[model samples]
Target: MTGGAVRPEGPRASERAARPDGALMIEARSISYAYKETVALRDVSFGLPKGETLAVVGPSGCGKTTLLSLIAGLMPSTAGQLRVDGAPVQPRRPGTALILQDYGLLPWKTVRENVALGLRIRGMKPDAADQALREVGIADLAGRWPHQLSGGQKQRVAIARSLALGPDLLLMDEPFSALDALTREEMQDLLLSIWRRHRTSLVLVTHSITEAVYLGQQIMVLSPRPGQVVGLFRNPTVGDRRAAAFHEMVNRVRDALEKGVNGGA
Candidate 1:
């Protein structure tokens, strides 16, 4: 599932290192969403600093995915504002990219072709598309179909495709939830490595507190249905996932989620 290569535009520097002063990249001001009679989000507001990873965690049906959709412009908000780089986000924009839980690779296409699909859709040449595959380290599996690759391989391809676009903002929706423990860890490490190479602001939604702590410089815990941000924690000493401080932050987030589910916090 490798993505095709793009000409690599936008800001330079590794994604995490690029935000020296921590300027805002994505902003949600009093954002709310509803479906028919059901309220999905309620006055959820947060700011994602450029080149930083912000992980959203909450119980099932907490509108985590809906929030991502709003940020990605997959759907319109019923109220409030959603912005990217200070401007309203538009779906399929060059400045942002999305990676779904399912990988979303076309079964009929080979790994290379699937990776290149985005660029091809954007009207890029074949040569440039091939280069994107190489950037994601799936060049060897370029000709293989999605069914032929392992779960981790498929995820790598999905990520490669996203990176090939050189997006300033990257949205991920429980991307590793479907994989086994070992594979999920591998994917996490791979993602950190890639983020180091390309400095994209990341907004990842997940149920795992541990996963959130491992990847995010900042973590936001949302309450149950009609989601609202209940708690926020920042880890200044990121990258040391095993540190006591990191574990403490993880426990705090987990407690917040449990409290939110039980209507305590």
Candidate 2:
């Protein structure tokens, strides 16, 4: 991935790099969650610094999506504390967006309408939605309905909708799992480009080790159901999946997941 011409990290990343390293955008302390009789997570904790990315990877039902929901304030953690910008996370928290694997688009709405839907909450001008579509390279398809688009295009609409809101924190739960391998790779690259340009804080929940190592600044592995933090690996140079270190990091995360599932964490 690094073979291409070297590019700048963009002004936002450069500007954000000047902030104190200890300045965190989100902090989870011993967070635990449950649904009636089922516990999904336990004593899960991590700190995500401003403008950095974290990828949560584990086996099925490891509370990866649950963690994203807690951060997005979709549901409250049954125990412990989850804070965004030093305050308790709340529903509809300002500057937060969550993208799901299903694309979450309304079949009845046109591409432009779907993208414009979220922006309507802020009374943003139509041009803002148009810009978002362009950002995702889907501007030409604005008039088409969701059913008229391919899986990748539909996902692009979901991304455009979130970007239209100009979120500072972006949470994604297997957002690319449904796409074909080639499309998934394209979307991954597009996502990283957007992240660098906007410097938004990102947390992705995925099952793919290669995907985790490719995009995560901090890769966290979780144990089985009633998920617990097994290990956290830093991958500062993970921008290029082709790099030797990227593969090495993927192997490390894979081992951690295996150990975690077997109660070795």
- The number of the candidate with the highest TM-score is 2
Can you write out model 1's per-residue Cα lDDT over 1-265, one digit (the tens) per residue?
Answer: 0111111111223433455574678777888999999999998877777777788899899999999898888889999888888788787778789999999999999988888788888887656556667766778999999999999899989988877676888999999998999999888888877776676788899999988888887788888999988777765545567778778878788888888788874
lDDT of 2 by residue, 27-108 (tens): 8889999999999999987888777788889889989999999999989999998899778999998699999999999889
TM-scores, all models, native as reference:
0.90, 0.92
Off by over 4 Å in 1: 1-17, 20-22
- Rate residue 134 of model 2 by lDDT: 98
lDDT of 2 at 121: 66
Badly placed stretches (over 4 Å) of model 2 are 1-20
Q: Kindly provide the TM-score of model 2 when superposed on the true structure, using C-alpha atoms.
A: 0.92
Error of 1 at 25 (Å): 1.0
Evaluated against the true structure, the overall lDDT of model 2 is 0.84
